[model samples]
Target: NAGVTQTPKFHILKIGQSMTLQCTQDMNHNYMYWYRQDPGMGLKLIYYSVGAGITDKGEVPNGYNVSRSTTEDFPLRLELAAPSQTSVYFCASSYSGGGYGYTFGSGTRLTVV
Candidate 1:
């Protein structure tokens, strides 16, 4: 009840469609991140926020967006979905960056056709 939670465990999107991958946490963490893992590859950071009202881009953020309106919520938005965006999205949070381990949600598997 006090960890990360992601909605829509699986999803399929048509070309040019859009959706928001919902992520929330009850742990009151200040650091949150969105990562996408392609098949046979490691996780690539998409976006991250150090605290509420502050956000920054990560390694891969061209097709994604994120907002940290509050301490518990960090939603990932996919606008004009493309096949290249197909991947497993993971939402994670930590009390602070480094040292402390992150709590990750189950993940959202997205496929674009």
Candidate 2:
């Protein structure tokens, strides 16, 4: 499988601007997730979807939104971005078990100025 891929590896947005971090996978995973990794900190879940039409908010869902319309795509939308939203975003996909451990994307580094 091709695993997961994210676009705009790096980005710098103004305080009120917005952006969409694209994500896709070829593994036919049933679960997709969005997470943010702060410097020297652990990953915090932003949003997740168990399957198509089953999206939900995660630990740090503020200033962010997501949708999983298909098995391959789960894009994260940042609206009215703030400085606190500046962080490394990652997209992951898994086949619905702990054993799979999820496949992570290269990551999208965003800086909300």
The model with the greatest lDDT is 1
Model 2: per-residue Cα lDDT over 6-78, one tens digit each: 9989999999998899999999899999999997889999999999989988898988888888989999999
Residue 34 error, candidate 2, Å: 0.4
TM-score of each: 0.97, 0.95
lDDT of each: 0.95, 0.92
Q: List runs of model 2 lying over 4 Å from the truth.
A: none
Q: What pairs collide in candidate 1?
A: none
Residues 4-107, model 1: lDDT tens digits:
99999999999999999999999999999999999788999999999999999999999888889999999999999999999999999999976799999999
Cα deviation of 113, candidate 2, in Å: 1.0
Model 2, residue 109: distance off in Å is 0.4
